[model samples]
Target chain A: MEGLQTVGSALLTLGLVAVAVVLSLYERLDLEREIGVAVVRSFVQLAAIGYVINFIFGLENLGAVALLLGGMVLFAAWTSARRAGDVPRAFAVAAVAVGVAAVATLGLLLALRVVPATARYLIPLGGMVIGNSMNAASLTLTRIRDDLAEQRPKVEAALALGATSRQAVAPILRVSLQSALIPLIDATKTTGIIFLPGAMVGMIIAGADPLEAVRLQIVVLYMLLGSVSIAAILVGTLSYRSFFTPRHQLRKGVSG
Target chain B: MASLKIEVRGLGYGVCGTEILNGVDARVPDGEITAVVGPSGAGKSTLLRAINRLIEPSSGEVYLEGVPTGSLDPLELRRRVGMVFQIPALFGTSVEEAVLYGARLSGGDADPGRLLEVVGLDPSLAGRDPQTLSVGQQQRVSIARALALEPEALLLDEPTSALDEAARRKIEELVRDLNDRLGLTMVFVSHDLSQVERVADRLVLLADGKSVGEWERGDFFSEAGERARRFIAGRL
Candidate 1:
């Protein structure tokens, strides 16, 4: 009963504070509609997620867990592809690739008992890694596509001058991959000094020791760096080929 | 003996089963500039691209220097035959890097100073970002980059259509200079008849994806085909 009351009180306080922050930001930054939509969607989505997670946790079946994870991946992929307007199919492939690679690598760490495979630990950690990788892949794919479109004439000129499609598109590929990796590098550089990331703070709030929380955060950070790096590289390389035909000419339909 | 540099026979392309270039047949000569002039949507660009296999021909073959383009590795073929575009398409942040892109692709070293000089650009402009340069400067950089491969043939698609008058003159002058000095075999597509007259050694007039007539530079303006006359009169 007390636990329910505490959760209810905390929820109300959080809701009020969130509303205040959104209102203030909207007023100051002129992002009113965006803030409104984001807040409303976040509230509804979080509520729905809370119920679904409660149901999943109650079941505690490994198959159910796997199914939920798959659904999460698909959802992440779909969202990323939609956000990346042109090359939706390629973006979808990139998202799936990143999600699978990141989740599998992180899952192995947990499966190998490198990290405990508790639902509380695994689900959120996997979600964070997948989410970050999805963002990186989306950015990388979009940037590469845009770069290719913008520099198409130059690419053609290169092809005319004996450069393969890979050689022709190399400049854009290198730039996009580097740009996609920037956030991961920045976060890694600034970790613990500039910010205490959510996972570590959340763990501490959940009654974990500070030292343990920090240690787990470090693992999460490293996992994210690895996953995103792999995602960016794979997405950039594969997407370069996606824009070209088998004959190594830029495909017309692939244009943005 | 005059030898053909590029031969396109019965080339066609389409999307979702609609033909874009239909039965395009033409031969680009080894040491001359051939201007493909047509109204918009007449497959002028497609025809130029077809030579380098930039656009896959749905039902035809392109022979580059007596070797079928289809049989030859596209990378090797493209390396020997370079293309320029309507817009200045520089990829890198700086002008020098954009010029170096082709050289890098071909695994050749770029002499930036010489390339800039050939294109009539100031050497100081190399360090500036390509986006900061005028359209004319960017186009010149693109030309220089294409030349870096020391290609036997050069394909251009409406290369001067995007520039202002001064920029257009610069490109026209550069095209003439390159042709005369380097003996670069050039194939350029354009809708502007005057520009074609100024740059082309020969003109291949296309209408509705078919070649309607061919004329040498001296006789192109006096050609008698109705479509050619209409094109010259800007009735196209």
Candidate 2:
């Protein structure tokens, strides 16, 4: 295939975005402005990331890679925290969840020798893991908060019966974590059957060996499951504490 | 006379700079049903919750059988002083499971059938889902669940407020039976003065977040203050 120039590539993507904008406008969806903003923001953000990744990938030091990865997790946490709404210190919870999940998953992979501990291997993989984990944290926290609020009487009844906060919120936590994992589980179950995943397809388009791409994609999928589950669990456990007082009283008005 | 089962001294709860309960003091004697009654927003429920530390008092303390509520582990305190809400909120999938929930959490044993029977429920209802039961039946299941904890006291928050006349009578009879037979210390929040008249041995009158007066049933009906009289007259 002939290589397209940067301007040509940009215009091609812009053309696709224009199609979406036109459809939204014709449908009176009121999403045309949001689509335009998202397109612009994504373009700028991806361009900045491209430059940053280029700089980091050139460096051999682990410290630079860690710093960049930490920044990504922090940014992802802040975004997720917005969805967390009324939970006190929601941003801290998100940050801790994302940080813990990413570190634990990456550490396991390194210990298993599934992936080498190098910036080349760590940055992209860590970014994907952290991004999904952030989503899992936010979804679990928000859902748990909503569930707790909705089931306040049930929880209070449990607490009144001598159940601890953990005991009282167990059902709510279970449902929240399961819900948070559904998207990732669905994607994993359907991978390569309904649609080719982006990572594998990207590798294939870039001329990598198809078998190697599939193997890498499998590893990525498994890693995502682990990271998301851990993130959900941590977020659910920590965020629930904020919903009740030390005296086991359910604090009202915690809903977003 | 019964000893003081729970003491609330200067008990106050403030939320968002507004006081819900302020410096309210009262005594709930053992082996009797004491009803906290007043006009709406009188903090009757708040007082009940504070007894078990479910709503931590902003100032002052609750003494449950001599131990300050603040000094006890909340779970332990709650186990010792269980509560039943106006609307029964049962946990677990089935009535049996709901009854067992407290026992399981507390690492104790309770026979669901026996507990249900004690609360005037059919043992056959044990396997049924609590949601499938009538509101009154569910309330009985709620009482059975609390009883499984073997609490020294049971706080009832408008326990019969949602029931029909028949169910209300059933609950009132049950409360009286439990108090008379088991010598249970019961503190209930009630808006229905007639229901209060039927069951309460002593009454605590609250208005504007303070304890306006405390009286025995006969005294309250015949010798109440102007504020208390207005409450009784449904004018407050």
Candidate 3:
């Protein structure tokens, strides 16, 4: 019984997914097939990513790391831009935000010698920061666009009273940024109590010392907080101008 | 009082394929109320907004004090020609903050209490949240917010359409007082011809995005063109 060898481990994972499918059928929930498909996709994608990361780690070259990180940022921006529907140059805007924040944060960490300047350390840390900041940028941009659309009267009222575009949308901008950061803030506040975050768990599973894992986890959390804050602010500030015209008129049809 | 404060020449605005204002031409005298009266979709609001550059005209020019609006910084222009929307759209949480919002943005010294007093509101109401105020009071706060800028001209878009009779009369009195005391040029969009006649020193009739006719307050009833007459008689 060797405690589930490789083949047995694979089947055990499949069996766990089967439980959800069975329960879904018993409860008449329509998500049985979706659950199955999601499980399979996650397994396949993670396996593919594992191999890619292994290859990337073996490269140990600065160019390869930079190219990979750039690709990740481009893809992240593309996904984030979907949330900012109808906003002009949304992809470019998100790319700039996520790219700048992730780079700046990682650069600072590397300069401080907190993270080594190698593919092994940089790739994972940059990926984590970029991915979280992407989400923040997407949420903030989408929220700001929607708020500007819904609150046209409020914005124009401010404009009519000689407020600049920046002044006109300031309140909504503040709210959007606050809303965008709320999820990260809450997760950070309840980190140990609610659940073990992914980075710490991954470190522990890799046989690192628990105390060392906790320290790395703290750095990851702080990095995410700083990077996401920058991302949200950049996205929010850059996107508001699109809501107005050259003559300072509020654009009524705020769409593609 | 007779100098031209706002001159709209061949102003046109179109959205997509539909024309909102088709070459509107009119002049607003300084220190006088110019009532723009038209039927629904006559581009009354568009014309007023165009004056303040809130809605850019597709082809035309708006001159404030004989200077083209295009040449000035829009923010600066907007400060000079303040506007009030149909609905009382206050920005900040409290009434005092709302009144001060514009003034602060324009880098002006805004005395909330004095602005409130000028708008006929009790100075104590400054501390209350604008959301808690009655619609009429909110509308007054809107006016005070605009006046805080100490603008040379004022644009009102159906300022009383949402209010009751008493509230409407109060706003009308406030408008007249502001005009007389400040000598501010005013362009007010209204559907109510009676109110226009009662408070406006001059009247401009717009229909189908064009200025059909204009007259002094005394002559509008007798000398309005045929189409404006139909609109006045509720027959258009």
DockQ of 2: 0.77
lDDT of 2 by residue, A1-256 (tens): 4465565676687888888889998999899989989988988898898888888878788899999999989998998989887778899999999999999999999999999988878998998999999989988988888888788787888888888888888999999999999999999999989989888998888888999999999999999999999999999888888888776778856431
lDDT of 3 by residue, A108-140 (tens): 998999978998888889889989999999899
lDDT of 1 by residue, B39-153 (tens): 8888888888788777778888988887888887777777788888887767778888988887786568878878999989998888999999988888899898888878899
* Candidate 3 chain B minimal-lDDT segment of 10 residues: B223-232
For residues B28-111, write the lDDT of model 2, one tens digit per residue.
998888989888898888888888887778899999877788989988988899899988988768999988888898788899
Docking class of 3: medium
Cα lDDT for residue A57, model 2? 75
Give each model's whole-structure lDDT: 0.80, 0.88, 0.88
Off by more than 4 A, model 2: A252-256, B223-227
Per-residue accuracy of model 1 over A1-256 as CA lDDT, tens digit each: 2233454665665666567668778678666666668767887888887787788788877677667777777777777777777773665676657776666777778777878765666677778877888888889888988888887766776676666778778878989989988988998899889999999988787778999998988888888888888888888777778788878888887553
How far residue A25's Cα lies from its native spot in candidate 3, in Å, is: 6.1
Output the better candidate (1/3) by lDDT: 3
